[model samples]
Target: MIKVESLTKTYGGFTAVDNVSFVAQPGRVTGFLGPNGAGKSTSMRIMVGLTKADRGTVTVGGHDYLDIPNPGRHVGVLLDASAQHAGRTGREVLALSASTMGLPSSRVDEMLDLVSLTESESKRRVKNYSLGMRQRLGIANALMGDPQVLILDEPANGLDPAGIRWMRGLLKGYAERGGTVLLSSHLLHEVQMIADELVMIGRGQIVAQGTPADLLRESGTFFRAVESTQLVEALAAAGIEASPVADGYRTDAEAIEVGKVAAAHQITLIELKLADGGLEDLFLELTAETQRESYQTGGAA
Candidate 1:
């Protein structure tokens, strides 16, 4: 539902986003992930036409965001919850958003209830609302138009664990109902749990994009184990190589096949385990080297 092509953005000499491209498909939640200063927010801004890209284009359902008639009716964005008016009550703010979008005032009330803020402290100014409450109000505002696409940057920030889980379920429900969701967050575990696909950026470039499982599978770690003392011989016979692990062997062979080979050779199974590399492990490994390289370059300078 959302497509970005070679989107590039620069400020003076600093490139904030560089030739990044990715797609957010309908009926799926796509996680936009990157480290701090990795251009996630910048890219999001460009996608929504809040910030113009130096090069490339972003389209929502084949129309440029700026050119889309009633863009808010098609894309619900919560890039910054704090961007709301501090003096207005949450209901007032949502009502205003609804009015601006030519949507019914009833939608504002529905969204407030949806976000569980229907009985919020009556007549309280937004400045008095807790961060989490404000965040919920922001979500309500985003939902006022019943947009088909949601672009939420750190929607889980400041939310309690329960609230975070609620948010996850909400997004999942939205996607299940055919809405597209693009979520940007620093919480890898949350993203790992919720995202159907991942778009990972590093230093303003897309380092990886795929299903979380696919990315993890590609970068996954493998373990090789053997039960008998003739471990090296068994591996050689099977045309496999093994490396010494802590009190065992670590090989990039399938555990079931390895076990079958061991059993065939009468190798007693002492210890055997497969270490599947997960999303967090793979994400760290992929981004850590880039951080180290940047640190080294900075030190040299």
Candidate 2:
């Protein structure tokens, strides 16, 4: 398991990560989620020892990342796919990583096959490869040692729909076989499809963390009515403030409660259902406030 305890980081006076703590457990896929500048990358970098934490600790298995000998055999990490050498071929890059991790050359070809990279494509220089190809090569490099733990930051950024589906199944299978996976991405729908748990961060602090179902259960109910103005006024009068949507309203009250309110107000209901896209809604709600504050102050977040 990957354990992070009160992780913190700062650049000059700006605190990038603030007392962040969480765990990516074995045999589970944990989705690390947040908006841009929410400190997900900083935390991941600290986890792999690429950046030093001003305070707190992060450990893989039972030891610190820097303390592990030949760490590649225990953990696979892909923070930036474009960070590879431009002069080297895709196969060459994997070959070099395999050599550094003390793996035989055969593992290089095995990973290439696993990622479905053709021999011709693998022979091309990194600079000539497309972004999707680069992502595949980076994934292959990470898996070259067949590490038990995976930490990927936006691995599907450049992937096509088919590639994204392939990656989802691959990681799901990997976790099923008892490997731990921590994935961070902006694609909410894709993450919702595969992630077993979610950790939401905003302004460098965790705002929510739970199973998908748990988080959704905590979200507001979506309601629509023929009398939109009356429904809004009724809900507001009952101490339930609902935000208007394109064709509906969202409130934190339960469906039964909404029904009771509508009945009391004599409002004609068109639709009432538990909201899907709960992750997206929750993320926007949490980060939008901070973003607004940043905009008002004329300072970047």
Candidate 3:
């Protein structure tokens, strides 16, 4: 498990992280989210001892990250995929990490395969790999020791749809196996799909933290039809009140009822799901007052 308490960080006159606190439990994926420069990166850096916190405490597995022997064996981190040495081969990077953690050479090969990097690709220099391939290599390196806890920042940034899907499944399986995953990403929808808990930060402060269902104030079914007008008519005919939200309609009716209504009307639904108010809606609502149109005032937290 990862726990952070009263964490604060500052740069010169600006406060980067303001007494931020959150916990990532084992056997669950915790999604860390924020706008650019909201101190999401800074907090993660502190957790891994990459940056010193001005005040407060952070611990991984009941001990400070720096105090852990062979920390990589217990906690994996991928803060910046592009930070790997350009001169080294993908295989060499994992090999070096494995060596540092006293892992066998076979572990390198296992990770490379797990991330779907072929022998040829692993042999290529890191400078030559595409962003997606670099992400894969970075993941391979992080998992080189089969760490029990993972702290990843934007791990899906460069992945294609299929690659993202692959990663979602991999992380889900890892959590199901009782590992802890603290994932930070701008992909809110994907995070909503996989994360068991969420932490939202704004202006260096935690704006909200909870499961998606807890944060979403609206309880209903959301559905969008190809012919929205006619679907609204059909729903009204069925004595259901619906309100427009995003590109869809939200109704107090359950998903099955909405589906049945659409089916009876032959309305083609483009999307249908329970309205746990979606992550996008929750993010925008909670952080709207705190969001900066540009990061100029927020600094490079």
Candidate 4:
């Protein structure tokens, strides 16, 4: 399991992470979600000891990551797929990682196969590899030691649809076997499909954390009326604010209440349903408030 308690980090006067806390348990895939500049990467860096926390702590299993013996064998990490040396071949990269972890050279071949890198591709220098191939190589390197936990940041960034599907299956299988997984990504739909739990951050602080079902339940209703302008005016008159959406308007009002308002306004209903765009809608709602605050404060996104 991974435990992060009151984790904080800052750069100059800007707080990159703020008193954040979350847990990634074994046998579950935890999705770490946030908008750009929301400290997802900063928190992950602190978790792996790549960055120092101003306060609080992050631990893998029961010990600090740096304190763990043969850390690679205990915690597999792939923060940046592009961080690998361009001078090395895919095979060479895995071999180097294996050597550093005191694993046999045969482990390199296994990883290459596991990540489905062809022999030709593995033999070519990383500089010549496509982003997808590089991502595969990075994943291979992370799993080279068969670690008990995995922390991947935007692992699907460069993947194709098929590659993304494969990665989802791979991570699911890993978690099924009792390995802890915490991955951060902008792919909300993908995260919704695979993550057992979600931790959403905005402006360096956790705004929400729960299972997909729980988050969905927190989402408001979405309704559209035949006469959009009249409906908006009617809802406002009823002391309810509604925002215009692509299809129509969105409000926190339940379907029953919206129906009453539409009926009173002599407006016909076009569409009325819960606005559950799954994780996407929830993520946007959670971050939109912070985004507005950032604009007002002239803070970096």
Instruction: Report RMSD (Å) for each prediction in the order shown.
Output: 5.1, 3.6, 6.7, 3.7
Model 2 C-alpha lDDT per residue in residues 188-273, reported as the tens digit of each score: 98888899989999889998898988888787788889997898888888898887543577788889988998999898999997
Q: Write the per-residue lDDT of candidate 3 for residues 134-186, one digit (tens) a residue.
A: 99998888787788999999999899999999999999999999999999998
Give the top-scoring candidate (TM-score).
Answer: 2
Tens digit of per-residue lDDT, candidate 4, span 42-73: 99999999999999999999899999989999
**Candidate 1 segments whose C-alpha is farther than 4 A from its true place:** 222-277, 290-301
| Pairs with backbone N, CA or C atoms under 3 Å apart (clashes), candidate 3 | none
Superior candidate under TM-score, 2 versus 3: 2
Tally clashing residue pairs in candidate 3: 0
lDDT for 272 in candidate 2 is 91
Q: Give the C-alpha miss distance for residue 83 in model 3, angstroms.
A: 0.3
Model 4 worst lDDT run, 10 consecutive residues: 292-301
lDDT of each: 0.81, 0.88, 0.89, 0.90
lDDT of 1: 0.81
Clashing pairs in 2: none
Residues 9-109 of candidate 1 have per-residue lDDT tens digits of 99999999999999999999999988888899999998888899999999888888888788788889999888889999888888788888998878876
Q: Give candidate 3's whole-model lDDT.
A: 0.89
* lDDT comparing candidate 4 with the true structure: 0.90
Model 4 spans with C-alpha error above 4 angstroms? 233-240, 260-266, 289-301
